[model samples]
Every structure is written in structure tokens, then in C-alpha cells.
Target: MTTDLVERVRHRLAGESRGTDPIALAEAVRAEAGGALSHDAVLAAVRQARDEFVGAGPLAPLLEDDTITDVLVTAPDEVWTDGPLGLSQTTIRFPDEDAVRRLAQRLALAAGRRLDDAQPYVDGWLPARQGRIRVHAVLPPIAANGTCLSLRVLRPVTHDLAALQAHGCIDATALSILQAILKHRLAFLVTGGTGAGKTTLLSALLGAVAPTERIVCVEDAGELRPTHPQFVSLVARPANVEGAGAVELPELVRQALRMRPDRLVVGEVRGAEVCSLLNAMNTGHDGGACPLTELIRVFLQVRRVAASFPCHAFSG
Candidate 1:
């Protein structure tokens, strides 16, 4: 299909039956742009229109691919994906940079965030219908090049200790050690870099907790999925453009403290929330867990170890 035809179809379809009926809309668009497009190209054009205006546009297919763990849009012509085999580029492309910008802005809005020149970047977790994507979008001033959208596919992988062992996320020795940590009620942190299976590992460990134990998890994006029956989760919320309502992790940590939690879980420690979490730990909130990005900095502040501790930390 020609660009002119696609544009014409998009313009006409922007009304009443745009996304509600893709099939009928596609048929109508194909008829409207007839004679010029080849028989095979007509169907392609139809599907393209459906993808463009009706759905997530170019990103629906990528999001549907279970193997793809991430989708990176560096530019309109440049799209990359990271799967089990690792990062690689794909053939997905938009008409221009503006299309990418529109898609990014729509995703942010769909997730109840505001993104524009005033706020060049946004960070939030999409609803389940949007594939539960963790979104971080940047515009020209902050991005240098153009609009860039980074989406992390948070697939449901709340595995148990044995499942982690089966998937090689942890060796048998590590699994045994992790179970011992839970059994003994030792307070420890999961120190690892991004995409290092830190959240996956921590979720598995939380699953091993006793059913009777009450666990509360505070996160920026609600990434952790614990199998424990009594798991309670709280996610941070960003303030609007007016800057009236904003809820941070530290406040959630304080809120979780008064709820009589047997164990507390923080998805990541980024700021004063760490101080509150540490204070709670010192006050005997044992078996708490958090992913510390800078493993070195965390250890540098640990002045001493237990006189006769039974567990050792694992680093990878």
C-alpha cells in the first residue's frame, strides 16, 4: 500500500468505527483505496491500518510474543528486541518519528501518566491489559535524538524454589541455601544488576514462605508476584502535572509498618525508603528482602557480621 493511501485511510477511519471493528474497517479501507493496490497488497494494507489506528499500532505483535522480554524503540526505523537468544533488531518500523512519539505518548496516557515536552520523560507500570509493561519514555531534550520508549515485559513467572532450580536461575546449592535463609528467618538482600533475574529469584524465595506468615511488598511498579497466600502489594504513584498527589516508596514502607506485617519486601531500594526499611529491620522485622542495585555500596556500609551466622551471601 502506498503512503498516501494509508494516510487517506487513517484520516477517514479516525471517526466512529475506528478501533471498535477492525475487520469491517479494514474492508472499508481496502474498498476505499481500491484499483491502485495489488490484490496481495490490499490485505496487507488492511492489516496495517488495523494495527496502526485500531490497536497498539506496530507494537501489538511484539508485545504478544512471549519469548520477547523487552522491546526498545531507539528510532522509528530502528526497533530492537531481547529474547532468550539475546538482543537483536527487528523489521518493525513506523512511518516516521512522529508515529513513534504518538505511540509512546498514548502508552503513557493509557497507564495514567502525563508525557510531553514539559515532562520529557515518564516512568510507570501499565495496566494488565497493556501487557503490564514497565514504561520509561523520553523526548528530544532529554533523549538527544528523538522520542525513545523503553518497555520491559513483566511476564508472570512466580516460580517456586524447585522451579528456579529447574530453570537454572539458581543451582541446587543456592536453592538449598535460600530455603535455609527463609527457614531461619534471616534478614538479607538480593544484590544483582538489572535483568539478572533478581526479581525472579526474590519472588521464588517469597513463595517459600509459610502460608500463615503475612508478607507486605512495596514497589515502584508492582513487579513482584509472590505465591504466598497472604501477600499484600503496594505500588508507588507519581504526581500529576499539577503536582498535587504523589506517593513514594518511603511512604508506602511507613504505611506497611503499621499493618502488622510478619515480613516486608521492597522491590528495590533507591532512596530514603532504604533508611525506613533498615530501621524496620533493626527493630526486628526479620525476613525482609530488597534488590540492592549497587552491591558494593551496600557491603561497604555493613560494618560487621553476625558473630556466628549460618548463611552466606550469594553474588552474581
Candidate 2:
């Protein structure tokens, strides 16, 4: 019945009938086909179909607003956006939790992903109809309150180092320091809290490297976007429902080492790969770095190993 309804709507939309309201078209089709579709049902079905076809939702307009950084959905009726000014509630609603779930599932499936009670949660990038989609969803049991969603939109273009310097993410001195660090091939760590501009700083720093050099970046979530020419990126994956296969971050790090990378970048080290990264740096893979805490762990671990190895020491 759903498939037939969808086909009918598609035909109506494709026919370009003048002065026909889409909801009305859907209702007429539903009545002709003897399907139980109300005005609200027709409206919802049309919106879903349109979003699936075009890849953008009604929220697409708000998502395109450059001033907004985050879109928070507390419930179908409550929506809020955060930006430089502050948080301001928007006039967007889902009608109910089921509507929200349907929209979430449609968007997820359109992105070649899944979202449902069994999985209950999803976190990944969504290819937007007009822009990028960073979506997170939580379902019941795990989410006793209800399913929650947060969407972050990435700008179509990225900023360069000079631009960042202008924004105070880095000053001239810090920029020069980073250049020297990259030039001397010294291994350094970039530390900061979440949303503290770690990846952005790393990307800008990587951009300063000589274009002739090859950089291999391994990430679990694939967030780093470097501007350098000779760059290779490897993203890790989780196991499927059947548990057939999975590619982990540590494994990717190990693999990147073998790819003859002039510089190895691991985006946000969070696991046993710390040992491998330290080994790589200690073994002459200079310019190795990750997020600050990971770097500190690596530094402390390296120092501990050095103290134990006796002959192993880092020379200034």
C-alpha cells in the first residue's frame, strides 16, 4: 500500500499538473486507490517523498543558515539552533515521536545507512540535498525520554591558516611555531578539549606542509579535511549486524605506516593505537601527532619506556 501510494505521488509530481496542491494530489490518488490516507497523512507522505527525492527536508532552509552551528530537536515540536549570538528556538516541529522517527529513518536510509529500534542509535555524516549532514539519533530503552537528534552543518568551503589566524585560533607566533615544527620534522602533539578546534588546527598546520610530501591520515569518523595535494585518507568502520567484518582505527594506523607516508596523522587517537603511534614516532616517524590528551598519553608512555629501556632517549 505504501509502495503504491508512493508510486501514485511520484506520477502526479512527475506529470506537472498545474494548480494541483501536492497534498490534494496525494489525497485524490489515495481515494482513487482506496487507501486510508487523511490530509495530514497525505502531507506527511508528500514531504517524506520530496525529501527523499531531493535530499533536503523542510529544515534545509535553516540548515543553510551560516550563522547557525547546531540544530537541536528536543521533540517533534521543539527545535533550537545554536550560534555565535546564542540559542534561539525555531518554529519547527515533527508532529510526534513517530513522525520524527520516520523522518530520521528516511534520511538515514537515503544516506545508505539504517536507523530503528533494534539499532536504536546512529551517528554519521549525511550527504545533504543542499549541504552536509552530521546526524546523531537515540531511540527508546537506551533513551527512556525519547529519541534525540542533533545535526551539524559544515560550510561548503573551508578556511585556510591565515583565515584561522585572523579568527584567533592561532596567532602569528603560533603559526610560525607550527611551521618550524613541520619544517624540522619534529614530532608534536595538538591538545585541546572537545570542540576546541583540534582538527581545524591540525588541518591548517598540515596545509602548511610542503605539497611534495605525502600525508596519510587515518580516522575512525573521517572528519579531517586537509587542503594539501598529496594526501591519502583511510577511515575505520564498525562491524555489521551479522558481525562479518570491521576495520578499526588501530589497524588503519598500522596500515598507514606501511603506505610510505612522509607524515602520519591519526585523527583523535582513543584506543590501544597509542602504543603503535609511539612506536612509530620513536622509530623515526617524526611529525607524528594526534589530539592533545592522546599525545600526552603517548609522551608519558614514551618517557616511561625510555626510563625502562635505559639506552632509549629523545635528543633535543
Candidate 3:
């Protein structure tokens, strides 16, 4: 099919159709052409339109692939993905930089964020029925190139310690040490570089805790999916465009302290919440797991027998 025909159908739909239903779209396609479009053309137009209206536009198929762990967009023509085999380029390309910017803005809006020149970056999550996507997008000047979009895909599968060991994320010796840490209710921290499976290891460790113990998790984006029976999670909220009704991690940590959490888990410690979390663990919130990046200096100041595990493995 020609691009002009698709463009015509899209223009018609923009005026007539507000929904992405294939049947309605097909009817509109045929009606816009006065019943001239063939079945193949109509089907093609509907599929393309549906893709545009649905999740992640052209990147929806890649997101749906369970094997893919990360998807990156550096330019309209440069797209990369990370899977079990590792980072590799794919054939997917955007129509232009404007198309890439449009998709980024749309996704940011879906995540209840703003992505424009004034606020050129957004860190948020796109929640799905089966999995969640952590979206980090930056505009040109901040990105130092074109618009850069990074997506970290977290599927809804619980990785226990055994699963981690099986996947080579941790050896049997490391698994035993982790089990003993939980058994003794030792407060521990996991640190690593970007995409180093810190969150995955933390989730698995929390999943190993006793079912009766209450586990409360606080995160900027709700990405942790542990398979424990007793689990509670609190997610931070960004301020609206008017800069009102913002909830940060420190406040959430203070609230979690009152909830009688046997294991208070901080998904990632980045700022002021470090004080609140230290107070919690100091006062007797044993069996705590904190995952962070380049925040060990803060942990060093607090005198505690907490174990620090640096995760370097990347298992998709």
C-alpha cells in the first residue's frame, strides 16, 4: 500500500474516529473512499492506524517480546535492544525525529508527565496488564544528541533466589549467603552500575522472606513484583504541571514506618529518604533491603552491621 493512502485514511480517522477499533476504522476507511478501497488496503490501513493508536506505536511488538529487557532510541534511525544475548541493533526506525518526539511526548503523557522544551525529561512508568515499562526520555539539549528514550521492561515474573542462581545471576555460594542474611534478619544493601539487575536481585531476596512477615516496599516507580503473600508497596508521585500534590520517597518512608513492616524495603535510595530509612532500620526494622547507585558514602556514615551486596550480573 502507498503511504499517501495511509495518510488519507489517518486524516479521515482524525476527523471521524476517536477510538482504535478495527471494525469502526475499516468502515471509516471504506466510507472515506466511497467504498473503493480493497480488502487488503483497508486491512493494511486499519492495522497501521491501530498500531499508531495503541501502545508504544511501532515499538509495541518489541515491548511485547518477553525476551527483550531494554529498548533504547538514540535517533530516528538508531534503535537498540537488550535481551539474553545482549545489546543489539534492530531494523525498526521512526519516520523522523518529529515522530520520535511525538511518541516520547505521548508516552510521557500516559505516565502522567510532561515532555517538552520547558521540561525536557521525564522518568516514569507505563503500567500494562502483564508487565510494566520504566520510561526515561530526554529532549535534545539535555540528551546531547537527538531525543533519547530508554525503556526498562519489567515482566510480571517473580525470581526467587533459586531462580537467580539457576539463571547465573548468583552462584550457589552467593545464594547461601543471601539466605543466611534473611534468616538472621540483617539489613543489606545492593549496589551496581546501570542495568546490573539490582532490582531483580532485591525482588528475589524479598520473595525469600517468610510469608507471615509483613514486607513494605517504597519506590519512585512501582516496578518490584515479589511472589510473597504478604507484601505492600508505596510509589512516589511527581508534581503536576502546576507543581502541586507531589509525594516524595521520604514521606512515603515515614508512612511505611507506621505500618508495622517486618521488612521495610526501599526500592532505590537516591536522596533525603536515606535519613528516614536509616532511622527505620536503626529503630528495629530488621531485614531491610535497599538497592542504590553510588550512595555507599551515606551508608558508611551510619554504623551498622548491614551487609552490602554488589550485583554485577545482567540476566534478562
Candidate 4:
């Protein structure tokens, strides 16, 4: 049913205006795709296509809005956003759950990922400005309802110390303290809740790194954009639809280590990869760093009394 709707929508869109008026297009699609699906479903399908081709579908306007920081969709008819004014709902509505599912699948595909009933959920990034638009979507059973979507707009890494201070994210004293920490090349972690400017601050500080030093970053997704003159990055990959060719964060850390970086950075310290990273840092990789948004347990199992639980036993 969805495949047929998508085909018809695509055919209709070929002749439609290039303008980004979703409502007008939705009305036209409803007229063209008469009885194809319900009225709402046809509109949803059109919006989904619009998201793929013109805007982010139902979300193009909100995403383009400079004030909005987050977009959330709980159901086809429901949309909410967080901006300078905080969380609020919009009049915009999706056609139906199927339309929502199609948008989700389209976003996942944009990030070179697959999302379907088999996968149930997807977490990826969309290439949008310096704002790293992180996409997370989930389908039924796991979702217990319609597809749920969460989009976060990450700040660009072009910010500097002055920029951070201007935004009131740090004070002069705090700036001095942070600079001292970085000047000494001390390994450290920054913690914060959602929307707390953690990534923004980190990006600015990374820009402050001495030019003579080389930096290598490993992350689940490629979100960091440090202004360092010499920097390399390795992004973790998930198994494809065939469950093959997966490159995990831990392994990427190991690869980064061999790159001879003066500083190692873990975009986020999650999973068993933490063990590999910790072992590496404990075994002379002192200048490693990560941003801890939430505390996850790190199991440091003490091995038998005889064998030392050294870096030898670990493998990313």
C-alpha cells in the first residue's frame, strides 16, 4: 500500500511547483491521489515526499526556524518543538502513521541506514548546516504506538572561547580554569543534561588546542567539528541490512590510537568500548577525553589474583 502511494506521489510531484508550500502540495496530492488512500493518508504521503525532496516534509519550516532547538513527533496528528521559548505544539499534523513511517525510513536512508519492522528503530545523523541534526526513530511494538521521532540540532564547532562567553555558557573565571586544564593537557570529561551546551563548549575548547598537537576523534556518529589545524576522526558504523561490515566505536578507538594522535577523543564513552578506552588511557594514553552526558556504569572486573588485568587482556 505504501509503495503504491509513494509511487503515485512521486509521479505527481514531478509536475508540481518547486516551491516549498506543503499545504498546497498536500491539497494537490489529495486531489490527484483520490481514493488512493484516505484523505489524511494522501496528505501524509505528500508531506513525506516533500520532506525528502523539498524540506524535511512536515518539519522543514520548524527546522529552518532559528529559534527551535528540538522537534518531536508522537503521532501522525501531533507535533511538538523546543526552541528559545521552550516546548510547544504546532498546528502541523501528519497524514497518518504510515506517513510517519515513510518519513522515518526516508531519514534513515539519508544517513545510509535502513529502518523497517525488522529493525524497529534507527539512530543516525542528517547533514544540516553546522547543526548536526541527530535523528532517532522507532516503530510499533518497541514504540507501542505510531512512529516516534526526535530531532536535535547540534551547535557547530566553530565557536571559540569568546563566543561561549558571549552566550553566557561560561564566565571569565570558568574560562581561565578550563584554559588551564587544556594548557596542561589534562584528560577531562564534561557532564551536562540535554541542551546544556556540552557539545558547543567542547567544540570551542578543542579549537583552543595548541596547533603543534595532533588530535584523533572516535565517535558513534560524525558530529564533532573541531577547529584544530591537525585533526582526524573515525565514525562507528552499524551492521548493514545483511548484518555485515560493522565498525564499532571501541575498534575505532584502537585504530585512532595507531594513528599516533597526540590526543585521543571519544565522542561519547558508551558500552564495552569504555573498557578499551580506559585501558588505553590507564596504560599511558593520558590525554584522552570524552563528553559524559549521562553516567553509565564501567565494570572494571579484577581478574584472578595472578594475572594482572592489564591492557594486554583488552581488545576494542
Candidate 5:
């Protein structure tokens, strides 16, 4: 049967033949079988043998390791991983630069992007193995040393509001203040330095919203996952290889406004879109909220305007 033929070929290839030619191996197997298979069948068996050998590469096992948060490769021989403790060296090695280049190209292609000498660098999220892959690579004169690669592995969500409270991210007074802000539909911003739990506070406030009202979120990295019934999420996209197609957060914000959102949330405001957001808030979009940096800027702008003129004159 064809199944038995396939298995026989696999078994023969699995042995330590030490770089035996596939055609020679197949011909030997056919000769022992009393010429049962034709020449074309032997060639087909040889091709399958070669494919099975190369397809059993080691990338799958490395990706499956949960503790490995990142994978780094400066060259084919140098591989490393960064996890909970810190960066540790890895045993995984590629045969040569060509091998590393091939794997990088495959990963980039799988992520719907391209990688090559012309476009020697790429950054994107790739859905492969166990978790998402954040790939960055540099080649040749730009790299100086050699081709470099870094991958960031993202884990699943596991924490909730109670957990955040336990970590002192929110106190009773702060919690109450957030609730009042949400309840009264007052526009507010939660500001903090990097890694200061800005997104965490935003997620908690969004979680406090009424389940019936619709909430639209626009983000660049798709990190905000608010626990609400009526929620819609949109993520932006970078330009393609040709630099023709791209979708940005501001465009998504404009589209989200047209969707009749009861509440609008932007994950981060770092560009001209702040002007659009300010216009929206000042023009009856009361409940809109963003991070604290923006909130402080608006507050300072208002304070400067008040200080510039007399109180009675401002009232008039």
C-alpha cells in the first residue's frame, strides 16, 4: 500500500546513514523489493524523504517553551532567550547565515510581511507556534556586526481588578473618584509615567462602565481588553512593503465616532489626534477619556488662559 511505502521510506531515512543520497537510498530499497516500484515511484519516494528530513527543524520546540519571553539570534551560532529571571544563553544553533536568513524570511512571510537584503529590517507581530512573535532584524552594513534578530513573546491575560487592588494600583479614595467620573460622564484622563499602570487604570475605569452602553476602543498594539458587554476594538496597521497601504489610529478614531459610540477610548495619544480629541470633548463629547499626560496638558492650557485674563472679564 502507499501508506506502507511511505512508512518504509521514513524508517530508512531515520537511520544514521550519514548523508546518503536520497536517490541511491530509494534505488537500494527498490532493488531489495524485487523491482516492485517503478523509477518514477522511487524518485517520488526520494523527494518525500528529503522533505521529511528538512521539515523536522527545531523552531517548534523553542517556541513551545512557556518561560521563554524572547528569542535572540545575533548570528547562526549565537542564540539566546530572555524570560523571568533574565537573558540566558540558548543551545539552539543554525548551520550558517543562510539558514538563519531562511528562517527569518519564512517567519516574516508568515506574518504577512517581507524580509530580504533590500528590505533588511522588519518589525511586526507574527502568529506562529504557541504565542505571538515580535520580530526585529538588521543585516550587513547597517548592522555592522551581522544579522540580528529579537522576538518578544506575549502571554495570555490573567489579572483582574481585585488583583490590581491587591497590588496597590488603586486605593479606596482613587477607586471612588474613578467611579464618580464614570458615573457623571465627566471627561477625565489617567496620567502616569511609563510602566506606571496607565493602561491598567484605563481598563479598570472602562470595566466600570454600564454594560448596556456601547464603548469603542482604538489602539495601536491591541492591549486594551475592557470587560464590558458592548465593546468594539480596532487596531492600526503599518505600511506594507510597497509603502502604499497603511491604517492609523486617528483614522480609526474618526471612524469610531461615526459608529455612535456611547464612550470613546484611545489607548494612547501621541500625535495631532489630540487636537481632534480636544475638539470632540469641547463639543459635547463629555465622557471621552484618555491617559494623564493629555489630561494635564489640557488642564495647564485652561489654567494659563484663566491666569491671562481677570476672572470677571472671563465670565463676561
Candidate 6:
């Protein structure tokens, strides 16, 4: 079968220092099959092998759809995607649990993270050139139902307030309020639940900022693509398998302060970075903003405590 031929080709090319060359894969396919497969079959096998080794085997097409925001794989046969229309099941299915595991490992490896028995989970961004992709994978025992992979395809789009209104993300009154907030350079937070439009709204609002002002954003994932000439972002990095070469959010926030940013933004607040960000905002880092989703209730409580302060403590 095609899968068997792809496996043989993979073994032949294993450890070879070559990219996904069509010529190499074709030769390997012919040699593996001893000329039994026709030219068309050989081409098909080459594509399959290339996908298996270097690409997102079955999920490439799904990722290519810019409208899709999330791709979830809970089981070997269960795949789902969420987008503007909301969550929906997909027909894409892996051949087996082994195939699913292979894909999860490969994607984690592509993201420069290791996923094995020792490190059963990986949180990183997928290595891609066209757009941003955030990847998270959990292996067996932890996953409980085979390898689970979550792919967040961060679409690159410039959404202004008008565009957001057109998308029904906000109404006229809310848009006016947001415009007023930005006009006054207010420090604020956008709180919402999972799959909420926090990132989208933040990006749109940031995009509407004054062009002369510099916007520097810090995020664990590089999801914000505001259409501003002075927009610069610092994304956090996870520690490697050896537990080194990691960049945390708090450090990035401190670094951003030194960048002389006119507008300071954090994609999300999740850890000790909250202190750093609070210091930055309270110390006259005007036009500061970020979204909050994780620990929503706790963040709300923190926001309440912050609001009780004397002056300019993260006002809504």
C-alpha cells in the first residue's frame, strides 16, 4: 500500500542531510518498489512521504484555511476546527494512534521542543513562514485517549475598529467607548473567556493607535499583528530540554520598557509578569493595555484590588 511505500522511503531517507527534494523521494520510491509502481503512483508516494516527513501530514490543508483559528485533535479519528462559524468536526483523521503520535512528535520537534516519555507535553509555536502558528501537544498517559494536538493558526490580518464592527465584534456604543479610551491613553484590560475575541479586539484597538507612537507588545505567543508602522513585539520562549535558553514574559516587559515604547501591550497576563506590567503602567507607561483570559476570576479580583488604589491604577 501507499503507507508501506512511504514508510520504506522514510527509512531510506532517515538521517540523510537533505531537504524534501522531489527527485530524491522519487528515486527512493522507485528503488524501494523496484519499478513496480507506475510514474503516477511514484509521484503520489513521493508527495505522501514528503508530507509524512516534513509537513503536517493531514492537517496542512486545514492550517492553510485562514479563517480557521483552532485545530484540535483529541483522538486518532477525532479532529475538530473552530472558526467564525464556531466549533465544528472535520473529516480529517489519522491512520492510527501511531500516526497521531508521530505527527505530534514531529510538530513538537519542528517547534524546537522535544516530546517523549520524559517530556510528554510541549508548548511552542510551529515553525512556519507565511503566518503564525501556536502548537501544544500532549502524549499518552497524560492525554488518556492517544496523542492530543492543538494548533492555533494565528491569521495575519489588519483589523481596525471599523472592520471589527463590520464583523459584529462590537457595537457603535462600545466602539465609541474604545475610541475614547485610546484617545485618553488609558491603561485597560480586555477580559473574556476561552475562544473569546480578546486578541482580535486588542489587535484592532492597537492598530488604531497614533502612527507616530511606538507600540511594543510582549506575548508568550506572537499572535498580535497590528497594522502599525512602529509596532514591535517580543515573544516569550520556553526552556529547552536541558532547561536553558528560556525567555520569560517579565524579562521581556522590562526590556520593552527600555525600548522607549509609546504604547506598552501584553498579549496576555499569566504569571509574575503581572507585577512587571503593573510597575510599567503605574510608573507612567501610558497607553498600556493587555488581554486577560487565564484565571479570569482571579484576574478580576486583582483588577478590583488595583482599582482601589489612589491614582491611575489600570483604569477601565
Which whole-number lDDT from 0 to 100 does residue 26 have in model 2? 60
Residue ranges of candidate 6 with Cα displaced over 4 Å: 2-7, 294-312
- Every candidate's lDDT: 0.79, 0.71, 0.81, 0.75, 0.68, 0.85
Candidate achieving the largest TM-score: 6
lDDT tens digits by residue: candidate 2, 215-239: 9988766667778898798987766
Candidate 4: global Cα-lDDT? 0.75
lDDT by residue (1-316, candidate 5, tens digit) is 2445544654655563645476656754574456877888777656544433442144555566898867888887898887777888878776566556656766666666778878888887776545456677766667777778777765433355666778887777877776788888877766878546687778877877889889888877666766788879888887877876789877888888888888888778777566556555544565777775556665565454445443311110
CA-only RMSD, every prediction:
4.8, 5.4, 5.6, 5.8, 9.4, 2.6
Off by over 4 Å in 5: 1-68, 128-131, 156-158, 190-197, 291-316
Quote the lDDT for 270 in model 4: 55
Model 3 lDDT per residue over 1-316, tens place:
3455556766776787456677877876777667777889788767766655567988887898989989999998999999999999999988678778878988999988899999999988898755888999999898887899998887865778898888888987898898899898888888888778888888888888999999999988787889999999999988876678899999999999999999899888876787788778767677888887775665563333233313311111
List TM-score per model, in order: 0.83, 0.77, 0.83, 0.78, 0.67, 0.89
**Candidate 4 lDDT, 1-316, residue by residue in tens:** 2556556656666667445477666765675667566867766666566665553677878887878888999998889999888889999887678777878888888867789988898887888864668899999989997799988876555789888899887899999998988887777776777667777777787889899999898887676788889989798877776778899987988898899888888888757677667666666665667887765343222133114454443222
Ranking by TM-score: 6, 3, 1, 4, 2, 5
Clashes of 1: 0
Off by over 4 Å in 2: 1-45, 48-56, 111-114, 129-132, 154-157, 293-316
Kindly report which residue pairs in candidate 5 clash with one another: 190-292, 191-292
Instruction: Tell me which residue pairs clash in candidate 4.
Output: 51-56, 51-57
Best candidate (score: lDDT): 6
lDDT of 6 by residue, 1-316 (tens): 4567667778887756555788988888888999899989888777667767877878998998878888999997899999989889999877778888888999988888999999999988875655878889999899887889999887666788999899888899999999999999988888889767888889999999999999999998888998889999899988886889999998999999999999899888877788788778788888899898866665775676567556655665
Report the Cα lDDT for candidate 6. Answer: 0.85
Candidate number that wins on TM-score, 3 or 4: 3
Better of 3 and 5 by TM-score: 3
The true-versus-predicted C-alpha distance at residue 288 of model 3, in Å, is 1.7
**Model 4: runs farther than 4 Å from truth?**
1-55, 296-316
